[model samples]
Target: MADTLVADLIVERLERWGVDRVFGYSGDGVNALMGALRRAADRIEFVQARHEENAAFMAVGHAKYTGRVGVVTSTQGPGAVHLLNGLYDAKLDGVPVVAIVGQQNTSVLGSAYMQEIDLLGLVKDVAAQFAQQVSTAEQLPMVLDRAFRAALATGSPAVVIVPHDVQQQPAPEPAQEHGVVTTAPEWRRSQVLPFDADLQAAADVLDAGERVALLVGQGARHARDEVIAVAERLGAGIATSLLGKPFVDESLPFVVGTMGHLGTTASAHLLGHCDTLLIVGSNDPWTEFYPPPGAARAVQIDLDGRNVGNRYPIEVGLVGDAAATLAALLPRLRERTDRGWRDDVERHVRDWHALVEIRALTPADPVNPERVVWELNRRLPADAQVAVDVGSCVYWYARQLQLPAGVPAHLSGTLASMGCSVPYGIAAKLHRPDRPLVALTGDGAMQMTGLAELVTVARMWPRWSDPRFVVCVLHNGDLAEVSWEQREMEGDPRFADSQDLPAFPYAAYADLLGLRGIRVDDPERLGAAWDAALTADRPVVLEVLTDPAVPLLPPFPAGAAKLEQMRTGLQQEGAAGRHAAELLETYAAQEGAGR
Candidate 1:
């Protein structure tokens, strides 16, 4: 009989925890682990990502889409270090992930061996819940148990560092005694209802104010029905943080879009007019975007007690799951009348939508990026999952993309990492092969990480029967976000030498790799290009030559200082100054008039 190796035991335990696949790159340091994976090929699949960073991101994206613990592996040193960014993305977003990295052989413990670094030291801060290196075969099962448990409990990244030699040793034999490793039941928790007193206090706060508004985030995604019920009971207008876009139906009369710099004008109006704010399952960092400190009395509910009132000062803080809390609290609340605030906000939303349509339909020489995103939004399938990159694309998505209530999107929420969209889309496609997958990235972001992962998509495309994947590149030939930021913040002309990127033929590059490539340089060809990419026979790359001069400003108002700063910068710009200045002034003036 073959002795169970330490690597084999690790794979066995992962399968027990319901992990069927892992994303990683093979290396000499993890040779034994790779060999064990090969042996368990039928039960578990190994996805080869080009860069170790992309491997980690794929794991994060898989976790996001499936709501499971994402897993990724890498070799020692640089491979281990490369996992930090994606791990931190998981950490900051409060998603569960487990990272397994190989280490130098046990024999080279004290010596500064080649490709040997302190793996734990590099990852401890980011992998918040658990980070440890296994020293012996006996420690393997128990440590893996603890790591998985901690990730499940806290929704944070966990790390396990196994030395090369340690992975090749014999596994600890199964014992009759039960523990976390062998006989621990699934880590499922019973529903916890909020206390009567806390519920009453929250009800009292809601009852006192006539104009109540709701602020939601990703935590409220599963509790949408309960949230809408509470809103109906209180006549509350709903607004979301960027991550909470899936929490409510955007088409609802009083349901304002996201609330932040990327938020809608309607959301701003709703948040400002409310005398009471009900924050559910979100820790919104932008304090100014919410009601003023003394203006609104606040009540908050969250699954984690520590997050209660963390983002805003609250009169009543109820610590329970969003659905449970809302369900309990709704019974005690009195139904309120519209009081005309809802109508006002709804009108604002309608006007905002009209403005957005006008801007989207307005034709330019090169394709308008806003129009491209708006077109995609209209054409996207209901079940599709989109992974949007950072930079100027954030403005278009946050402003123009009307995400349906049930459709899920993967954005670099808090971290706002640039190159996540392509890899995230690949992961989404791998998880849900039937659904349409789209990766929206700026040219710079695509150049950074999206281009490298094309080969990965090409490799995996043949395996799935219906692999509908599209990588939409907004090739604006510059980092438009940074350029706008430089002008708005520093009152300086965009430093062309630093911010400008050469015009790269991304569509041709895709064609060279034997994928369907569609390029749209004119607005007339834009509609067909999107249709072609969406219904292509193989994975497609749709590259659009968008205008670089478009301002990436949000619908929300900029303060006086920001407006003046942007004006000064625009004045310094050569011939393109007046149009940009007028856009800023027009929005700023409208904001003042509304207030």
Candidate 2:
């Protein structure tokens, strides 16, 4: 038998590590690695993405949804550079991801040869724990092992740069076979129970407060029941950071929606009035949205001690798993009566729902964008995985998509990148092939990077019988959020000239790719379109022509400068001006009533 190639060892190690699929685009530098992947197809699958960025995002989504280390490979220079945006998303979210980058021959180390770049230097800051270039084939196994170790231990991206020449070298043997090497990698999970003193201190902080509010992040996703139990015992109202949406049961009486710029008014109100804010597994970076600095004494619980009080001032910081910490803290605390706090929170939640319903159900000349999300959410499977892009579409989704507990959703969050949803949907479906997956994106966002990904979706799952994935395109003709931002932040008149985009016939585009397409222009037909897409036998694109004039009102109160800027912009505009004025008045009334 021919000696095993170094490339074979790379693929073998990945298989041994339990990586089932690799998302990436093929290129010259990775030619050897790609060939080895094909030979090892039974052991691991290679998911070809349209762009390296999408590959990176798919890996991020896979990691985020599966709690596994997502892996992606890219070619030299540009391909590796394109992976940054998606890698940064993983970085901010603190998820485990491994990026395998193919580099030019080592012979041109500093010659600036075609596609030759310093891959390690490029990813060091973002990859966090591991970013190394492999020079010798003999060193490959140990370096690859270290890469996986760093990713699994830190829950951060690890990058291994393998040059083309290095991959073609002869592989060394004597390494034990996969089954024989039975020892699992060593990685420390957060302490289940905190030290007795730390637990007591956390309990005392909670006991001293008359009113407490609970906020959760993605860290608490696996501990939903524990979070709810603690909230109920403390008579605390619960809110989620956008990423923490899956943690709270939307059906709960005291549960408010997400908290931040893309949050609910009820959540804003809940935070403002609380005497103690107990944050669990969240570092909600928005300082402005946080309740006034001194208004509430705060306590934070997180597995990583570094995240404690990272976003806000805290009186007590308990480092441990959310479930375990809360479990230990619960026994030491005194149960409090509701004292009308829950009732107040409930009323705000109800009012916010009323507002959303009114907007969602209202008919418009061009369909209201909110109606599309509402219909999609209603038609979606209870356990569907959702990926929402950042923009005007997010406003509709954040407020309208009442995600059921246990349903997973991916958002760009801190990075706030557009064109992420479709790629996210692709990876989500690949991870949970049997479950329904949906991608929600705006016209601008879809056009940016998602439209090209439709081809990949169509080709990825040709054998699946049911429509495994749905892409909902809210096709308004402008970068609606950017236009709104110009009006709201810069006092610019609503100008469609710069923001307007050609309305691509997305449904037709889908049909051409051997996928089902449904276009809904009328709000009355929106539900039917959603139903058709949901049941289609293949991937479906449901394009809804949305009204661009509708204002996406901020859930929280705006400062005087922003309010004045919006008013000035409205006055300078025409029909949109009148619409903006009405939206402002309606929101002002709702805010006053809720308070």
Candidate 3:
């Protein structure tokens, strides 16, 4: 067998695309590709995940953490099908990822062959920007390059499908022929700024209002200084979408914190009272938390025009790079001299900080989940990376865990996929082994896929430089988020059969893998447990026995209605819900007292 088959050429092209690693699992469909990867191991690395789905999640995480186009591969049929969940995660969160999937021989495709699948059709939705199949060796170069370019241009996942027979073909060296096509793997981002007229229009709106509020999202990540400058100029209070949390320093006096269902009371107050809104790089879907339709005159700035007025009606839409747009608008904006709005915003933030402390200290059955996250606020290292999964754990992560400046905390933001924390943490750690990573996940999510991904951690931790990977499992035997959603949204009691999770010894499983295990049942021990796990010699599973009854309450104005719904649902639970009702009331009382 020649060493330079089409498979070999494919690996070479990936190297040219600047992909250092590819996450995947093997099957018969991709046997040729695997052999080529093995032969070219020095240049491109291969990471084997526990499952194909997890491999896809790793790819998404890689893009989010590394700020590069992530690459993933899998066989056709079942393997190709499993990549959908993670591909959706990448698409929904605007992360760039490229999936190279193997297909059955072209001859067998229409014959209904054993492993045949309509590969192009399968990835159409998730890889909406680009998806193509390589029919000839000569087609490989163009297909691969376009996938990379399209992914970067659109900030979404792309796909390249190669047939099993196509993989065995000799690497094509196309000469100057009529039908031949070739391309280069290169992508560059432009410093796109808004038109001068639009920038002036945006400034006019901001100059008119005294009580201005700025809402930011992940798109503002690179423009932190500019965002703060704009907020300061307008005497504006800042509130973030959860995806934008890590980009801004949470300790800022006029920063009201994240605004949404699991957001801060200060954020709710800021949005509720503001007369003018300036949205920067965020299309957060929580419309209820925004200033009511006619309450505020809004100006939105985003590079992607599609999100200009996506969640809110705005008087001005400035489509441009956030930093450049903000800088241009700054010259036209007159600085606020009243300082009254700034002082009120700072006071609200100060009150919020104290209220959170009281909420974290509230009594629970064994341990308050908020306390587990609150303790990490001060202990998080300057360089630590955080990966959080969806569920009640996200509520704590969103509201309690105050990220240190420059620390990145990523989750399955828009897709809200559970079981992402383990895979995301692994990908971040694998990319930068020198830095420590902490994953916050609920027990329901832990049981879904985290338990299996631990084996991947056990297999790889010995190769790491820091060797510190902490997986904090909120061992509350319930699907708390959905349960609360049912109560809050539908005014229904918790259906124990659907919400309860089977007990699993997360700590013991870590011990089985020869990693450290620490279980915390007492609230007083949360800080010590966090300290122990952060400083451990190897991977540690910090399984926290958290309370499921702690209410998932939104900030006020919107939260008041949800609070009534929750009480109504609890009233119907009879004896089964008395303890939960009491806990809910206690939490509600604490919020009032703290405020």
Clashes of each: 0, 0, 0
TM-score of 1: 0.96
**Ten-residue segment with the worst summed lDDT in candidate 2?**
179-188
Model 1: ten consecutive residues of lowest lDDT: 176-185
TM-score of 2: 0.95
Model 2: number of clashes?
A: 0
Estimate, for each residue in 265-295, the C-alpha lDDT of model 3 and write its tens digit.
8999999999999999998999989999999
Clashing pairs in 1: none
Give me the overall lDDT of model 1: 0.84
The candidates, ranked best first by TM-score, are 3, 1, 2
Q: What is the RMSD of candidate 1?
A: 2.1
RMSD for each of the candidates: 2.1, 2.9, 1.1
- The lDDT values for all models are 0.84, 0.84, 0.92
lDDT, residue 141, model 3: 88
Question: For this target, which candidate reaches the highest lDDT against the unseen true structure?
Answer: 3
What are the models' TM-scores?
Answer: 0.96, 0.95, 0.99
**Taking the tens digit of each residue's C-alpha lDDT, what string does model 1 give over 1-595?**
1487999988988998899989999887889999999999999999999999999899989888889989999999899989988999898888889998899899997799999888888886997579999998877887888888888788889999999999999887666554424544256755767889989999999999878899998888679999999998887889988888866788887788888776777888788789999999888787778888889999998887889889887999888888988999999999877557667767877877876776677555487888899898789888888898988887788778887767889877888888999889988888888888888899999888988999888788887667778889999888989988899879898788878888788889889888888888888777888888888888899999987766655555535546767777888986766765665665565555544
Residue 390 miss distance in model 2 (angstroms): 1.1
